[model samples]
Structure formats: structure tokens, C-alpha cells
Target: MREIDVFIDTEEIADFFYQELIKRGFIPAEDEIRELADITFEYLLKKDIIAEEWDE
Candidate 1:
């Protein structure tokens, strides 16, 4: 199998969502935004779209 390294800036992603929501006039809470981001990451991980890195 081929492997690739991916760097994800989760904070940046959350910030982007927050900004978009604000522009739409739906101001979401910080925790809500974070939870949404977590759910997204979890879905991607489950589908093998992304992998969690282990620290040795």
C-alpha cells in the first residue's frame, strides 16, 4: 500500500467554519464548532480518508 503524509490544521478549519457561519448569521458557540470539527475528523478517520499519527 502507498502511504502519504498529511498535515491538518484543525484550528484553522474550525475558524473557517466559524467565519462562514457568522457570515450566514448563525453564530455558533466555540464548543459547538469544535464538536463539529471533531465529528468531521472522526468520520474521515473511520472512512480511511485520514489517519491519526502516533507519537513514539
Candidate 2:
């Protein structure tokens, strides 16, 4: 288990986060983008895929 402080209002997070992750063909809708990001973060958390402090 690990802990850290994060700052961001997901609602106001620069919009279309997942879409911007790659300059792909289709742009995902705002809601779909948020959902994709949420699901990805949850999966990473469960898999312990987070980066180590030294990574930064």
C-alpha cells in the first residue's frame, strides 16, 4: 500500500484526457474519456502499476 497527495478536480481536468493520450483517429466524447481514465487508474491501482517515487 502507498499514499500520496493529488490535486485535480477531475471535472475540470483539461477535458478529453484519454483522447489526448494519443493522437488517434477518433476523439472520444468527454464522458467516455473520463470513464476510460477512471477505469485505467482503477486497474493500475489494483495491479500495483504505480510508479516509484524514484521514477520521477
Candidate 3:
């Protein structure tokens, strides 16, 4: 998984990344976005960078 530390440090960055993913057609729908968020959350959890689920 891609490192999520930068995005975790800034909500704006996370939003920007999400937008880019959509713009690039990497994520096609809200569900995919949620899935990506889940993956990122798991990654963060593994790194112990975040403990709680993100309010998606």
C-alpha cells in the first residue's frame, strides 16, 4: 500500500488525492472511493499512525 502519512497529516491532502484518483479514473464511484479509504485505513492502522476509522 502507498504510504498514507502525508494524507493523514492533512485532510486537504487526502481530499486532493481522492480527487486526483477520480480525475485519473483510478476510482470510478463512491463505493470505490470507500474501498480505497478502507485500504488506506488498514495501511495506517498497520503503521499505528491512526487508531480510529475515518469518517467517510
Candidate 4:
């Protein structure tokens, strides 16, 4: 088991990723955080994390 912690200036986006992570049961390592942050939002959008016009 790994304990992952992320600190970013963007709160909303961070929270978004946190929820996505929880839903997917992902606990990314510190090194992977940056890469995850870079792509998680777009990934979630494509995956329909939220039902919005942009995603539809």
C-alpha cells in the first residue's frame, strides 16, 4: 500500500482528480502526481466523469 499526497495551487482541479482517484481506487506515487495532474482533467472529461456539454 502506498500513501500519496499531492499539493497544488489549483484547488478545484486537485479536488477533481482526488475524487476521480477515489472512484478508480488509485493511489499514485509522488513522482506520478505531476503527470497525473497534467492529464487527469482531460482524461476524466473524455471518460465522462461529469455529464456536461463539452463532454457530450
Q: Which candidate is the best by lDDT?
A: 1
TM-score of each: 0.81, 0.48, 0.49, 0.34
Tens-digit per-residue lDDT, 1-56, candidate 3: 77564345444445666799878877556666566666776797798877664666
lDDT of 4 by residue, 1-56 (tens): 55454433334565666677778999755445656665765676588553333324
For model 2 the local lDDT of residue 25 reads: 64
Output the lDDT of residue 9, model 4.
37
lDDT of 1 by residue, 28-55 (tens): 9999999888887788899989989877
Q: Which candidate, 1 or 3, would have the higher lDDT against the true structure?
A: 1
Poorest stretch of ten by lDDT in candidate 4: 2-11
lDDT of 2 by residue, 3-52 (tens): 77544344544355654655666656767777766766667557866532
Judge candidate 2 against the unseen true structure and give its global Cα lDDT, from 0 to 1. Answer: 0.58
Instruction: Report clash pairs, candidate 1.
Output: none
Which regions in candidate 3 have their CA more than 4 angstroms from the true location? 1-17, 25-27, 53-56
Task: Report per-prediction Cα RMSD to one decimal.
Answer: 1.7, 7.9, 7.2, 13.0
Candidate 4 matches the true fold with a TM-score of 0.34
Local accuracy by lDDT, each model:
0.87, 0.58, 0.65, 0.58
Question: Residue 6 of model 3: what lDDT?
Answer: 38
